[model samples]
Target: MSYRHTLTAFILAAVITPGAHAQSFDPGSMKTPDGQPDISGTFTFRTLTPFQRPQALADKVALDTEEAAQFEASERIRLNRDLFDPESG
Candidate 1:
């Protein structure tokens, strides 16, 4: 009788355990009571801006249009120089 009771309890636990798995929360479906989705929290903003204006800028706070164009042209030349090399015999 004791063995039968233990077997029954084991079977019951095995059947119920699958229903206790954790569920994921969907942020888009959540809302405040006043009907506006809550968004009053600290957020981070990131950018490609360099920590320091590059040395080529020479103490300039930001690049002017002409300076930016020159910088981009120089960078493209540096990157593509190898591609323009003549094929070796």
Candidate 2:
């Protein structure tokens, strides 16, 4: 295509594309007191906390300080990307 034709098509698409991606949402729902849309629930918190309790710790609701320290040490090593083998990644 000629440069002029390509530029005209690009400009036309840019003008028309926004409406194609328009979204609708409830105006009244999930608003904060200040009236911004409440996005408090949008985040999924990341933590090193285990998804399932270890079998030995199943009866425990929370780890005692000594146990917590040990768990954190192991998790630090496990989560450290620098410790990972490049091939494994």
Candidate 3:
């Protein structure tokens, strides 16, 4: 009820209770009744290319195998340029 009583209770709780930091992963914990590793949910691999063709390339129908490879190479280089050498802000 009083401030001193409240402070005493808080101090006692702080001293008695141990803080939980983290728990390590245990593969054995994840299991299913069938025991097939319990694989679930969808996994997606993202790419820089969009689903639809850009307005700039609307006129172009399709690229040849070599041309497609070249396009992909150029795109990868352009996208990863900043990652290789980040400019100072």
In terms of TM-score, which candidate is stronger, 2 or 3? 2
lDDT of candidate 3 at residue 81, scale 0 to 100: 74
Candidate 2 regions exceeding 4 Å error are 1-46, 81-89
Model 3, range 13-69, lDDT digits (tens) per residue?
Answer: 886665422355678767777676876778553675757786766888888899788
Worst 10 residues of 1 by lDDT: 43-52
In candidate 3, list every pair of residues with a backbone clash: none
Q: Tens-digit lDDT track for model 1 on 3-77?
A: 999999999999877766435566765678777888777865343344566676766777779977787766655
Q: How far off is residue 21 in model 3, in Å?
A: 42
Alpha-carbon error at 26 in model 2, in Å?
10
How does each model score on lDDT?
0.68, 0.78, 0.71
TM-score of each: 0.33, 0.37, 0.35
- Ordered by lDDT, highest first, the candidates read 2, 3, 1
Model 2, 1-89: lDDT tens digits are: 69999999999999878866565556777899888988786554367787778687888888889999988877766777578675854
User: Best by lDDT, which number?
Assistant: 2
RMSD of each: 14.6, 12.6, 15.2
